[model samples]
Target: MKCCFGFVTLFVCSASVQAQEANALVQQVKARLEKVADYQATAQMDINVPFINAPSSEVQVFYRRPDKFRVQKPQGISVLPKGGVRINLAALLAGNNYTVVDAGTAAVGGFNTRVVKLLPSDESGPVVLSTLYIDAAQPVIRKTTVVAREGGSYEMLFDYGRYTAWGLPDKVTFVFSAKEFKMPKGVTFDYEKSGPKKDPPKGDGKGRVVLTYKSYTINKGVPDAVFKD
Candidate 1:
């Protein structure tokens, strides 16, 4: 009986240590992003939602230290999915309100990454669950899967380039569910937007948006007014 008790105690301690390791790794990644105070970038966005037909557009992306992020279109309507603009990793990894579980490891974008799942204690929040794939060598998040309470779940994959030094991705791709996608209230679509209607969505209820960045003006002090409605 004493031997069995010791075994159980050992297992519990090992799990605790694993959780601590995972949490520390996450904080390290967050610390890396903390280096960049602010940035503005010009990104060419490709929109491909099942129910919507819209042409690609050039948009301005802005981010300020802490939790401010916004995407702006040069002209015309915005096609971002509901709750889709929260792609800032620095903001997402902020605070210690969530429970982290060590979910083992996986390969993302040809790089081996450690997988960790974050579950928010406050269930009422928009995010239900988030899984992060962190490349420990680069110490950057290669992919993220977020399940939200409202506008449906989405997955984001990151590709690093020149801005890898700041732990920023040069490209980001989002794949989300179109079935629950909601437009802004009182918004309507014109059938003659750019071209003919897209074919009805297929069996997979997924939609995708790709943002390929042109350039980033980093740490240049973006004004608070840039984020205002």
Candidate 2:
């Protein structure tokens, strides 16, 4: 009986240590990302869907502290996925109360990463669960899978190059459910001329949005007017 008790105690201790390590790693990533006060990013957005065909569009991305985000187009229209703003790492990790579990190691985009699962303590929050694959050597997150309280889930993958120090990715790919997506027809006035709408893939109705960042102006104070609704 004593031997069995000792084995159980050891297992519990091991689990506790792993949980602590995972939490600490998440804290390190949050600290690194908290350095950027604001940034303006120039990017190219490509939209591919069964209904709409959009040419590569030049876009400007603006971000400010505590959940301010705006995506703008200089010449043409821009349509983004619903719940897209959750892609911001800083915003995702903003909540202080949560549980982190170490999901172990995985290879993402040819880089080895530590996968961690975040479960928000608040039951009423919009996010049900989030899984992140973080590069072990860098403070950057390579991928994220967010499961919303609503039906479908979304996934985002990141590839880093020039802005690795700032924890920003040069390219990002977002995958989401097509059924949950909406684009205002007024915004894409020329969308129908692009092509005849085809039925989306059979099963899950998924679509992809790829964005490539051309340049970033970091630490500039963005005016509140820019983010006003």
Candidate 3:
């Protein structure tokens, strides 16, 4: 009877420890995301959409405040979005926006990781679904899978080398589905299409976009003048 009781006690303790760990991970991720009120960083972005008959474009992006962003491409006109900040890539893609549930364990970036599934409340949202691989010890998200509502999924792997107080990732590699990918020419009408499609190019299948951000200045006093057209 004593031996049976001891086994039962050990099982209960193990279950309790796992539950505590799961809760702690959720809080850690939430706190890290909430720390960034405002930040300025330079990013190198590579975008590829197979459906679009154009070569991949590499651009540099500068971000400021509530809804200010500027993207500059070599030998191309810069894209500056003033008021409507439709999307905050870092926050929407990497930050906390979904319910996290512990899926299990896996190996990622040569580290033992805990896989967490992020489920969105609204099924009809632009992002269909996402799954994240978080480093168990560092408690930072290392990789993510984003499923688009339009039947395409993108996988992004983050290699966080430099650690900031806010725990933001410096480098991210985006690997997207290569089949039937395409960006509307109207959106990038300024650029000449050079891929398989003609002037008004169609979509393709596969693509990838890798972004590297350097030297983040967070929470600086950025006024309205900085974001003015």
* Each prediction's number of clashing residue pairs: 0, 0, 17
Ranking by lDDT: 1, 2, 3
lDDT of each model, Cα atoms only?
0.79, 0.77, 0.58
RMSD in Å for model 3:
6.1
* Per-residue C-alpha lDDT of model 2 across residues 1-229, encoded as one tens digit per residue: 9999999999999989988988888998888788888998999887666676667778888887656666777843433323423767888888687889989899987998999999999988778899999886887899999887764577889988998888888998877666634432212224446776657745667766778999999997898776754
Order the candidates by TM-score, highest first. Answer: 2, 1, 3
Worst 10 residues of 1 by lDDT: 183-192
The numbered model that scores best in lDDT is: 1
**lDDT, candidate 3, 164-216, per-residue tens:** 34656787665654443443111232333544543321354445555677666
Off by over 4 Å in 1: 76-85, 180-196, 200-205
By lDDT, is 1 or 2 better?
Answer: 1
Name every residue pair that clashes in candidate 1: none
lDDT: worst 10-residue window of model 3:
81-90
Give candidate 3's error at residue 38 in angstroms: 1.7
TM-score per prediction, in order, is: 0.86, 0.86, 0.65
Task: State the RMSD for candidate 2.
Answer: 3.7
